[model samples]
Target: PAAALDTLARSLPVSPAGSAVAIAQDRAREKAHFVQCGVPVAPHAVIETAAQLAAVPADLLPGILKTARMGYDGKGQVRVATPAELAGAWEQLGRVPCVLEKMLPLAHECSVIVARGRDGTVVHLPVQRNLHRDGILAVTEVYEGNLPPAQTSQALAAAKSVADGLNYVGVLCVEFFVLQEGTLVVNEIAPRPHNSGHYSQNACDVSQFELQVRCMTGLPLVQPRLHSPAIMLNLLGDLWFTGDQPVAPTPPAWDAVLALPGCHLHLYGKVEAKRGRKMGHLNITGTTPEAVRTTALQAAALLGIAPF
Candidate 1:
């Protein structure tokens, strides 16, 4: 059955074998040793029945009810803010088996993306401070450049430990909660070129996607180096044309961005769009974070979104 999924992926127009294997391995571990790895997962109790869900601790209210598999981007999830909300939430989900975890009161979120080769050498993508809207990843900025030296070292070490423990190959990401006291708590891991690392495509010598392909295919990694301070702005579906009729071409403000120097645009070849879907990204590289931020926001505004 697992091989069926692998086969299906390979049948697609572009599927890398090494990446397929890495993703499968990550899914297995997330299901198996999630708690053992010291991740601050919500307090969860697996339940197949409404009665079982009812039996869960009341304190865990305001928790998330989630399906164990195949959930992403705020799908297949419901928030139970109180006892009265439980029955309705369960019914809405069609009584599927689910886990309930305590709601985390997070201050800010960040992720460390790592790339590892078969020989076990690993490289970390710069740490990114992420912003989310309605549980969907919206934008990310390099956070390590702003961190105190000691804190930055701690974050990198924690990420390396996770990569080594998993014997992970290819690009992998570990999301974390950066508390007010400056402590980092593990959140979750994704074993692929993560959304947070998209900025590397233009800012670094080797992009996360290329690193993923290289690591899995046994090619030596082209050591990635950031040439300049960078920022990335996500373009959501709301910016795209709608309806069955062909829409008039309103040329994007690419000219203004291109003229700014060190600005690059990447549009994923997705055929259609809907609210909240990631359509593309604009990256800006400059000497300072302020300059990078300014350029990135300008580019996004041209595409009709709030500042990054």
Candidate 2:
């Protein structure tokens, strides 16, 4: 669909995004593009059918297989801990086109967002430290010096190289896996503003969303400045229910959250509250990172997300 959409965005000459070229260089194709452009990514194999499982190289075992399209939040993925599991995992995914990527030992995960114009100008924001739960974004933290300086610089440089290669226009997010040995491996690519960038809305002078709109309109791209340290806690539908196996959905009390100073709550107005749904997010900002993190823990505890 991304290829189709990219092609569609190409034929329409009237769009304000200056032809909308390279709005998305999707995951499956982006890997090849990255390798060609000298960007480093994890060892992977493209499996289009179940029979291809037998051909998987021995070294790439203990990997994860993912559907090439429409998969998100840990869905459409199966863990292949051993070679024998490959056949069952293939059948589980219904023999769809998938990418078998070897899972790397991680020190932490982070992301860098790039906004590019048709003229090839690029803009980047402060890298964000991301935490995930059940394969969904659980929290985002934006603070100076919290991440390893070497790894941060490496991710930024790699992201810019990829963006330059694609001639990408619009906001593009590159997620990275920092290995235990301190190597940066490109994990995936999101074609637009991503969950990790949402913290910029409260901490930076120019948000990723604003940058996206600017790029699409052919506006001048500016270097984003961070004004405050902040933490963004994702409010998922699980909070609305009592527990994992929730029998009835009940909204949690919002008083503690609303009462906290410097806490900003943004809820998506969705009618249903089914489990795993992203209901909203809470952004907490402060003059310092410690203050921001302390208040965020308090907020999380108040929402019953932590034992405290």
Candidate 3:
């Protein structure tokens, strides 16, 4: 109900103004906004009719078709490897409005979180290196050297430009795909604090949630500082299931996980366990990046998360 929320925001003190929310709610508008900000995005085409579908460029084949709205966590998307697959994919999506994005050779993914104030001030967190499973965020790593200095700078600048272009007045997360050739292209934007920024809770002096509050309450926005190297593993409900032929959900060994140095667990208290459901996250912090990585891997092992 982004549109409904946007309407409510017009009469309320919304952290993100309705205008920004409206843009982010629609892929067509979001991509247009990114281009208007001079940020690079993958080649794509909008398809809402048979004529438009017929007109799609051949170069955009081997692309992913994504619905224009209400799709997240890998939902409402289909991969089409050829022009012939376009119609079937679109039909499978119920003929909804969609965009076809040319698939790129991705080497990695990363994101930047920016907090912008009504006064036009923008401050950002360190770029986060991310890994996804089945199109859902699985892990996020933040620290010095997690990404090359140049790539980090590029991501930060592009994020700032997008926020400033929107005149956005809240925390915004800009996700990007790092091509094998080292080129960075904007993927999409989250209008509020995002999953990839979860590491900020334990690693930063000022977390993204605090930044949102500051923006909404008219408090001064302080640039967040990362005090420790951190890695965040998304806790999916799949973790609650244990052993072969288990009859019921069993809680993960939180005690064992917490025994490791610098491991912090945050559970959402989800009432049920279901595969692929985001239940919470584990944040690992340490004095050194190496120590954090080692501890994080150990925690992952205990939780059955694959090594990254």
Which candidate gets the maximum lDDT versus the true structure? 3
Query: Residue 210 in candidate 3 has what lDDT?
Result: 95
lDDT of 1 by residue, 90-152 (tens): 778788776676676777888888887867888877778888777778778873365556556
Candidate 3, residues 1-308: lDDT per residue as tens digits?
A: 55676777778877687788888989999999999999999999999899999999999989999999888999999999987798999999999999999999999999999999989999998999999999999999998898888899899999999999999998999999999998899999999999999999999999999999998888999999999999999999888886556568888899999999999898888899888899999999999999999999999999988899
Q: TM-scores for all candidates?
A: 0.82, 0.91, 0.97
Maximum-TM-score candidate: 3
Cα-based lDDT for every prediction: 0.71, 0.81, 0.93
Residues 1-308 of candidate 2 have per-residue lDDT tens digits of: 44455466667622223222232333467577778778789999988855677788988889998887767888898999887787788888898778899988988888998888878888899988888888988888888896889888998999998787766777988898878998888887776788888888888899999998888788999999989998889888888877567477777677778788779888889888887899988899999988988888989987877521
For all predictions, the C-alpha RMSD in Å is 4.2, 2.6, 1.3
Off by over 4 Å in 1: 5-32, 148-151, 241-251
Q: Cα miss at 204, model 3 (Å)? A: 0.8
Error of 1 at 201 (Å): 1.3
By the TM-score metric, which is better: model 2 or model 3? Answer: 3
Q: After superposition, how far is residue 286 of candidate 2 from its true place, in Å?
A: 0.6
